[model samples]
Target: MIDPRTPVLVGVAQFVDRDSLSADALSPLDLLAAVSGAALADSGGRGVVVDTLAVVRLFADSSPAFRSPFGSYANLPKSLAARLGQAPRRTIYGPVGGNTPQLLVNLLAESIRSGASDVALIAGGEALRTQARAQKMGLALDWSEDPGGEPETLGPETRLVSAHEVAHGIAMPTAVYPLFESALAAHYGDDPLAHRRRIGALMAGFTRVAAANSYAALPVERTADELITPTDDNRYIAYPYTKYLCSNMFVDQAAALLLMSTAAADAAGVPVSARVYLHGSADVHDMILVSQRLDYHSSPAIRAGAAQALAQAGIGVAELDHIDLYSCFPVAVEIAADMIGLAHDDPRGLTLTGGLPYFGGPGNAYSLHAIAEMAARCHAAPGSKGLVFANGGYLTKHSFGVYSTDHPANPARIDPTLLQAALDAAESPPFVESPAGAGTVEAITIPHERGIHGPATVIVRLDSGHRALAVIDTEAAALIDTQVVGRRVNLTPGHPINHARFE
Candidate 1:
């Protein structure tokens, strides 16, 4: 018989509220409670074993000043538990990251494997769409709930980027990811036009998958030319990233997963068909600061985590029947594919849930939907394996998991710190918080706001070979539409800002 402590995922559910503009729209807590309850019902209706509940942190909850147009919950996990009438002994609120959902799963699996917990529920939800719509219509939604008392926070609350990065306007994901995009394009020797078409084709495939998914936020299929070719509707948010290429965060979506030890599942009488095993998982992070990365074209953390996960599962990439690489941007997917040794047109599609762009990002909870989908796929095709790759920050944190219906003959083992130590040991390029004199432009991104051009932000290699960020004025921004990498420029460092000009 399999070890009673072997952790297995027994149930998963996802809820997408496309009609959040209506009166029936659920708040974030409500969505979480509903999905958690649904997951319980899906898993043989066992309520006695829910000793732990973990919730993925929400973006709106990060700021004390962010008053939701729909009043928000003070304690998300506890409020959700009360609504479901499940008194879990421990409540956990995870950190902010696209990788949190999967990371939590890996952590909870360890807890169950150690016999510290018999069962756990992991859930997350976002009602940003309803909040935005209500605010636009000048209506106030009262989703306020104070369950009292704080839950134990699971992850660190440290800032992901540095003060220097923020000073140079390299803070937001949109601005920073495009720098990676430009570098990746250059690595492939593709010109501006050619690279645009290539990424467009890649995203168009995602849109087609989204069109077929019932829960996709924007399910309309789009063509490669339609996606890459900017129009009045799909304007450029940042160069090389049109509106269609970015993650759709304006979505009301929620997902939940229930994991129980094999003994608990058996006691609950969960059908054999409903069981999915957690074969292997690994979490790792690259250099926290993008400017300090060894290179821009790839992610060593992703490569390390993926390899470790597959190795732990005793399987190879060829055995994966389904895959869902985090698709916050085209570059994310492309870089992940290259690192995982997956071809762009692999027999197994890159995304199992369309992707973040089409399926809906839902803040940090996007990967929860991917996990839910992967669980369902495993149930449908027993013994077939699926892979879920999640990323956080600007390709800084990564987590990988492999799942299947077949239980491993060997015990499940996860070394959470191995990948992290490897990342920390890797050499980081020297980064200058501020630099002066002549420099060579390594990569640049010119962002647009509502079809209007903005200042150009460039990552330059200074005379000393250290990387620094600089912003160019409108005069220099005009030259950004063309290839600017390798262009010699002069940098003038100022208080909290640095200016650059083409030589």
Candidate 2:
């Protein structure tokens, strides 16, 4: 029997507009109320409102004149609480990261399982494009302006990057993901053109799925060639990465999920007919900084977390109907598919929210949209199971949740500490600071010396016909100016004319 205090995701909802026509196209408060109300309605039309409010941080739209006086952190919980007409027993504002929503759900589930509280709402929204349009039109749109201290920060407590990585331009999402992609490419010995095509094909499937999703912000389908081929319109942001291959975060969007204890749901007269159990989940972390990794092509934390999640649910890849593998870029999916024993071209397809690129990555809350979609799909498919994987902090933090129509075993828990310990034990190969004479092709970004300027990560493979992590002291201008990307260079020890490679 399920525990009376077992926390479950009782309802899920999402909202989006084809275009942000007005400043309030999808106001943060309105989105919260709509989704919360829908979640409540999904819970058998119960009039009961959420008693605990956990608001995800909303990123402000830079274009609009909207000052967001309360900052993205301060206004959401109070606004949601007012809309629900109930004083939350407790309120929390989370720190930034794409993984926040699932992390919040996990915490709420534990709270319900432990009887800390019941009937909670987890919600967030961003109206970026809408605000941008308003700025262009010179129209003033109404928004919350209350002020308060910043919410308690919640993210990796430690600095993932060392001073050296940042100094050399190893920061930012675009710069980081390409490093992994390049590593993946080198691992397979695929030429640049072939690798780009493979990634485009992988992401095309996600765009197809998004095309069918009514709430997808950018729902047009693109072919693999269209996505991967670089053009003036889609310039290369980083080596081996086109603009289309990156996550799109400029749209306005929001999603919310309602959670309740089994007892609380029953007491409120809500039926369990549509409930999907959070059967099992696992959260783990890899190296926080890219520079510390032994291998950029793979993530041990992702592999272990997915394994634990599937094991806890007593399921495997062969039995699953749908899977969302956190498609921030082609490399993420490629690596996740490798980890979960699913092929890149698995007939089941990889995404249900069209991946982050097409569906609009709404800050840290986008994966909540994936979970919401999974719940709806399971509810519709009867016995089918779905997986939602989330990532944060440059592929550093990962959380996986398995959901199914059947009620899960009572008192389920995932001890992430073991996974973390395993991650800590795993060793990444040291970067090659200097290599013997070998032919190399590389891309180097010479960042401006101003605030955080330097060439992002560059790849220099030894001519030994194998991928090599060529490291370098990037503070030297000679090393930064080399056009190593899409070109061949001779690596001679102590006689280098154009670049230096070593860590």
Candidate 3:
């Protein structure tokens, strides 16, 4: 007999509000409450005696300046609990990261497996689209609520980027991901045109999935040619990345999951058909700084985490009937596919609910939507297994999960610290804050603003073998249409930033 404390996902739900112009558009809290109720209903009833209410922190909550124009909440988890009429014994507000959803699920599953908790609810939502609409229309929305209570916070609050990266203007995802893209292209030996077609084809598959998904924020499908060939609408955001290739974060979406022990599910009268077991799960992180990474084209943490999770499940990637690799960018999917040993043209498809770019990134909660979709698919095709990969930061954090309707013989086990320690032990290249003299360009990116050329950022390997960043003017950026890797460049350290000139 299986252990009574074995954790199982009872129900899942996803919501997307595209009618941003409506006055009745839901706030983030409203979306959370709605999805929470829907998820409970999906489990066949309402109250399940939730012991813990955990929330994935929103992107808007990262800074006070980005607070919703409607209003703000003091205690987000507690406020959400009041809306759901749930007074969980413990409320948890998770740290900011796209990986938080899956990480929280893994942690909560362990808690339930150990009999620390019986039932838990994990939910997250983003109303960025609605907020943007409100701001554009100069409309006032009163969503302010002060539900008093300090909930327990999960994960540390640390800056995602390093000081050196920030000083070189490589702070945001837009800038940082392109650096990886350049490196990946060079690693694959693909020319500018060939690389564009390759990624465009990959993302086109995701768009087709989104076109079929009713809850997708942008459901329109496009051909690979249309995706790669830049038009007035699909202008270049960064070198090798068109606007359509980026994750669509301006979306009003929410997702939630209801997790409980098998004993609790049975006690609640949940049908066996409605249960989806998490057979395996693991979380790990790569080197924090991109400059210090041993290889920009691949991620060690992803490979170890995927292998560990599959090992715990006593299965391999071939056994998975479905998969949803995080697709914030083409490189993210490519790197994950390589590490997980999955083919780009795998018959099973790379995503369930489209991908972050086509379906809507929805801040850090994007993977929650993927998890919800995977659960529904598993329930529909009983006995089949699915894998979901969640990524946070710049491929810096990773979490993997394998799910199936059939229960696992062995209990779920995960040791993220072990993998993290291994990654930490790996030697990293030295990063130079300032450098003089000649260097070779390791990677380069030229981002565009409003369809116009912008500054070019380059990662240069100095004569001493240390990596440093330099910015170039648009005049120099135009000359780097082809591969810039191995191109000789002269670096001049400046007060605010460093300048590089191609030789």
TM-scores of the candidates are 0.97, 0.85, 0.97
- Model 3 TM-score on a 0 to 1 scale: 0.97
Task: Write candidate 1's Cα lDDT for 43-145 as tens digits.
Answer: 8845446999999988787645435766667888899889888888999999888999999999899899999898899999788888788888887678888
Displacement of residue 226 (Cα, Å) in model 1 is 1.4
lDDT of 2 at 168: 48
Error of 1 at 249 (Å): 0.6
Off by over 4 Å in 2: 61-75, 136-139, 147-158, 429-456, 459-503
* Candidate 1 to truth, TM: 0.97
Model 3, range 297-404, lDDT digits (tens) per residue? 899899999999999998999999999999988889999999999998898999998898889999989999999999988878899999999999888889988999
Which residue pairs clash in candidate 3?
none
The lDDT, on a scale of 0 to 1, for candidate 1 is 0.86
Candidate achieving higher TM-score, 2 or 3: 3
lDDT of 2 by residue, 1-503 (tens): 77788777788888886653854465666777787666667777466757678877766532234345333434567667777776676777765667778788887888888778888888876766666676678776676645443333454345666555554456667777776776677677776567777888888888899999998988989998888765776656665667788888767788888888888888888677767788878878887767566566788888898888888888887988888888777788898888778999889888889988898887668888999999988988977888888887778878888888788863477778877987898765454444555555443433333223344445555556443333344452443223335455445333221244442
Worst 10 residues of 1 by lDDT: 473-482
Query: Which stretches of model 1 miss by more than 4 angstroms?
Result: 45-48, 63-67, 474-481
Cα error of candidate 2 at position 47, Å? 3.6
Each prediction's RMSD to truth: 1.6, 5.3, 1.4
